[model samples]
Target: MSDTTNHQRIIALEAENAALKARIASLEARLQLNSAPPQSLTHTTPTATPELSAEEYLRYGRQLIMPQIGLPGQLRLKNTRVLIIGIGGLGCPAASYLSSAGVGTLGLLDHDLVELSNLHRQILHTLAYIGRPKVLSAIDRLRAANPNVTYIPHITALDKENALEIIQNYDLVLDCTDHPRVRYLVSDAAVIAGKTVVSASALKTEGQLVVVNKPTSSEEGGRGPCYRCYWPRPPPTESVVSCGEGGVLGPVVGVMGVLQALEAVKIISSGALEGQRAPASANEAAAGSPGTEGPSKPEPASMLFFSSYSPTPFKTLRMKGRRADCISCGTPSDPALKITASTIPDYDNFCGPGPDAVLLDPKDRRTVMEVGEMIGRENVVVVDTRDETQFGITSVGGSRNVPFVLWQRGGKVPEEFWRAVEEEGNSADPQEEGEKGKGTKGKEVVILCRRGNDSQEAAKMVMEDPRARDWKVTDVVGGIGEWARKVGGVVEY
Candidate 1:
């Protein structure tokens, strides 16, 4: 062959080699993904005796050696099934530990998809799985961590219709969700299904945990108190804050999640299941009769509070056992409190409606487009009601910072804010303004915040104040987030 022909062949061969490498990489990734537990293991039938493989023995050897969780406890873990709801911050660590400890079956249930914001605290999900269902992402990580364990993914929210049916299959349920309605729903469903629940929540450097509806003999006060026994009514919608709104430290939530796993593992190995007994010292075993129960005692109903900033980070509040008057767990003569699938109360109604963005009349609310026009106009005064930190992050130019918290505390707008408004009103060019520049009527006060809800509240407060009777008070319809999307000037965060 000629030299030119040989050079052309060399280039073609190099291109072919690159294509083959890419194909090999793709196949390897597929094999790794498919190497997870078989389809049969997804719904493994529990046998009377669950035997562990040699690989599992080595995998869980560290935890198995502990006297608290020896051979018997390991087998109990092999047979126990746990369902974790809301695979976000708390669920991520809790599931990781449980699967690593060799729990036979884990049910991962979540309705949300993985977002970029969830990665800091939701440890199981990564950048690769963003926009995917959280449960599927969690399953991928969990299966890789412990292939011996069975993982069942429920890629849907737990509602009254399906909560009981799904919860019935698991020995225990973890209420890792952040919302109040879901918490109540989980507790009610767990109570109805006769399952124990380890519920936990974390936000803003603080976390709270509780194990409720623990299965007990008739003598043990007919099972511990359900969540309703402690708080029958949900907190006011305004009082409840989410992680997105209030913010949370990543480690604070991770700590709460790890503790939840610890509680779950303890519950499983505590002789609560058939053919399993809490391990005892040799002396105690020798002293007791053959039929005598082991030293396992029911953990008293209690709430554990953790604050990362506090010197005493952990505090336990002992709670009363089940109440006779509890609407859900009670023996009230009224039958309406009892919740079944068909009788489950509408949680949205029970919790009350969420914040109303349209609380004010149309005339009193201005859209972001209108606000964009008003920016830098001396006659229009924009007051940002978000906190100082948020105000510093990104804000409309010439807008005054008057946080909503001041209004929430029943305080009037500060003198500085009025001074700024007065300066803006005085600086208006009468000749340039025309008819609108007549008297204080020319000045307009526009309220804005992170979201429109707080601005509406603040606008109402400002309107009610006697000081600004002549001024036009209105709030931006969708606040900074809307402005960021529509106008592209301010940062939404």
Candidate 2:
């Protein structure tokens, strides 16, 4: 029972030991594969640095070879995700450069439709996409520019309901939106998600850029100040004019967008964008906050301002650090003011009174076509509510110009303008009135403007006039734009 049985047991033990060694080797190999950088989901096999393909290397080699953005920085850019909030003036250039620079993932968010009017500034879209949703058009253009990046298009408006969820997926956010409510929304969402925000705004000949919500140093205690820290709330609606209303120089917006792209690139690459040369001026100041008091010296963050009209267009000023009581990012000093996504204000209300605040009843609005049909009827008068300068440029023949700005400021169309309108209505032949029984002796006032928005308020103002209580007042939906598009006429803005 001794030597033979002992030899058999030793052989069995040796076989078990060999099998265990093989199993351990297999497990170790599997672990190494799992720990490597993620391969492309489109790939059928694992690869080293699969994020950067051969074609990509050829495309980005010039930038990859730079000292500041070498291989490591290029890889960081490839892994970064950026969300561009709007595809209009600022977003067009920002998205374009970010994609070309090899950002790994891009989220395009816009709800507007491309129009012929947008072509001059929104370079991401073209005449071919005159009626397409902006995000889709942007995706098509961006994909053509760079297929290496992943494009996520959100073709809806970002509101309180969806802002946080959508923004949390991106490492950084570019607030290219035009609306104040949207600016605040993006800022708050970025803060809550702990993401950096690069914001840019352009109006007429001037533009401003700022980076917000960057991580603060240990001494600062918490994150940097958000948009709200700079602007506690949006300015009044009448005071805040958009590029659409006031008109902007295309190059102004383009320059701002490019700067926004630069900020995003610098943030992702972890490189200083500051130049070695001295600043242009010692007295340069940052763009001032509209309503709040600002620091005497440059703050932790910086705001860059540009103007086409200025001799020295670019100016940078430091922004204040984390506000101890910021409702969005919270003060490092005060815990009670700490805010969450749920605690954020209804952005629409905080921005200003919304459309619902002065919402007109549906019955009070007439389609542009319906108003067009009523144009030749007896006792029906068309009031063009645009300013006098706008009315002089282009208008429907025989329509009276009420000049909405005057009316808004507690003035009315001069008594003579109203008298002439009544005379024109009365001049319609009785026989014609008989043929078109829709005609009436009572005044039927139809209001129209560049777009339908101002017309509603204009109609309401005319209705409440002591003399016009008996008159029938209605606003033309889509205003002159619909009239020009559907009924046929020149719509020169």
Candidate 3:
């Protein structure tokens, strides 16, 4: 060949070589034999609905017969995983029902030990298990109710450190804890984990129930309003009362807890209606993988309030959906306000200072022993701030009943009521010089109730009143319950 012909032929051969390399690369991609991992196709894998065994059919026949809950609903319940964060009054009843109803996996978490006092409301912890870790005690009782159900007992407290990880493992969470600080933590952690929360609280004869962070629509970026959406800030320290202090009716908490399970069943069943069936493997659901799931379900009522004493019980409140400015569930107003595992705010601070921190002023409080010592002092006056019924049930020997509600009315109560209260305490000590005693006449006022919480709040009210400003006012620390325990059980609880 000539020099020019040979050059052209060389170019053609190089081009052919390039085409062969391109074909080889294409074949490698098709077979996924290259170094890079193959891309997954974007599609949902449908979860199959599980069927009931012969024994399961007979055991759940009553519920299965209901139209709202048939085989499909039962299967959904069997597939759903729930975590109950406290095994106290609310947790006991909630765990009981959820287990019997056949929830696939139930997680019971609590750091507290069972106590004698808990027997009245914490039904899951029995005399046999007293002094044991609450989660262990609760799990024992639950397993007896339904041995087939799997139970996960977390003996440690749920805090920011373990909350997100634990929460992400379950499909739903139950905020059965009594602490206000934990309530906010559970809600925030659930929001971050992309799970829904069912929360219930009971004190005295009243109870409240709410579902938080439920998905409103698959198209919506975030779930519905969270706990902070309505209660953007925690209630004032004095406004909260523990069941231990305030005293709850076991049946009242029982009612709320049972209803909490009902709400969970409803939430889970609604998903089945939308064709979001249970995963074939329990491991997949517990891992919270969207491995095989369908669209989200609308949330139930925003809130429910039940009072055993009310003429009409069980009031449902409608929600206004998610707030545009919600701190946890909304689009952040400030870029720095975003909440993540690392960015969760100090829950204690977000819930505000607790009662213990708020009542640190020396002049504002008296110990139970100090108040008990004042019982017979001629000049010291005791005011029982509980309602007439509670005061009648138990009270200090000589303390006069002045319902806290009358004082909280903020001048709505007649001036004569205060005068009468003061007069009762200042009854004439005939031995004193009339004019001299009258000048420094006001009695040192010590306010007390069942627990110190209400008494502290009442004491602050008394100190703020212009009419009582001259009075040296203080709350009884630990209130009558403490006084009873420390001072020979003089007061009834």
Candidate 4:
């Protein structure tokens, strides 16, 4: 066949596929409407057998054939409801898998709007959803993937006031949020509501996953530990790094999100849903014989760590059982530790405010415009403190790259920086001291980074150096980001 003919055939097949999906969605919607009990019927008798349409069985046929997830497991999955707390990188892929796997209902909760930056890691969001709410964006894509599943969008941040109420509606919760405060809030709320939580986080090339508050039989060492059980208190605020600030690989987060969905599926299929047991047929399939035991129970809780750069990229750390004195899940000896809807502790106060970016005073800072005007001037040195990779992307015309990492841990300032300053200072004429004294007597060292935060610290470090006493040292007020916003030439990323 000719290349053009093949291309045309491919497009026609895609159109046909889309039409079929629309028809399936319409049929499913009509089935649900027809099956729903009328409002006039205040109460109705429950059916002995749960309903699973022929379309559903065909949709999940591959997984249904697996002994681990036989007919009984499919029914359990069809009855499960899961709530994902964030619709960003982790939530996007996790929600995609769970909904496609036949989870009956999924609650997507997020207050953030879709952005150009989120497209790389957040798989469900597309360019068309750029400024739309993330939950709405996720719902549109997820519904198309599986029209039989129900999707609920909560276009608001999960706060103390509504955390428990919202979480109580779902059978399981996924803590895919980025912030520590919100993570604590979600874990606490899930524990308080007696719901299992699958939590995961990724930053840079590393990712972490753990199943917290997993339901267990009394013989299986009681219930798994809650989030607070592992960490009695939150980590220091300064140590926390957001994906926006520290940077994260797209696939790294996607891996963690997909794993979270897998864990949720395993937990649900293992008959952890409200102590409901799998049917005898499922037990027989799992046991490889009729009249045998039911499906095996969930594995003990353990934290999973993955580092793409490591030779052994995956490691499982066995987490200790629940801490006896855990404030969130421990004995209610202390009423303050017990979290209620009205008594949920202020997480911001508990975790402390995020790292402050403003450390230097007004005199030590220069606006991006001031720095822009001094770009190529004689005896004016612009030092970029971002990592070498970022500096290579795009930088000021005459700026010298001196990464901020070199200044950390009592490390000495790079000699190349001093050499650049000396070379620029040598070009200045002593006779130019009258009106151009700014960079004549000594070089003016202006530091900058992607954001103003690091530049402020870099400037403070430079100013404290005795060698910089004779030179005018200052940082850009908002770093390169400000330059991109105010001045037109520079690229922000």
- What are the clashing pairs of model 3? none
Q: What is the C-alpha lDDT of each candidate?
A: 0.77, 0.73, 0.72, 0.77
Query: Can you give the TM-score per candidate against the true fold?
Result: 0.79, 0.72, 0.75, 0.77
What is the C-alpha lDDT profile of model 4 across 392-415, one tens digit per residue? 888888788887777663456666
Q: Which pairs, if any, clash in model 4? A: none
Our model 3 lands, by Cα RMSD against the true structure, at 18.1
37 Cα displacement, candidate 1 (Å): 22
> In model 3, how large is the Cα lDDT of residue 450?
73
**For candidate 1, which ten residues in a row score worst on lDDT?**
36-45
Pairs that collide in candidate 1 are: none
Name the runs in model 1 displaced over 4 angstroms. 1-50, 217-221, 273-296, 355-358, 361-363, 411-442, 463-469
- Residue 313 local lDDT, model 1: 98
Order of the predicted models by TM-score, top scorer first: 1, 4, 3, 2
Total residue pair clashes for candidate 1? 0
Candidate 1 lDDT tens digits, 407-451: 666556666566656656666653433333244464789999877
Ranking, lDDT, top scorer first: 1, 4, 2, 3
Clashes of each: 0, 3, 0, 0
Poorest lDDT segment (10 consecutive residues) of candidate 2: 287-296
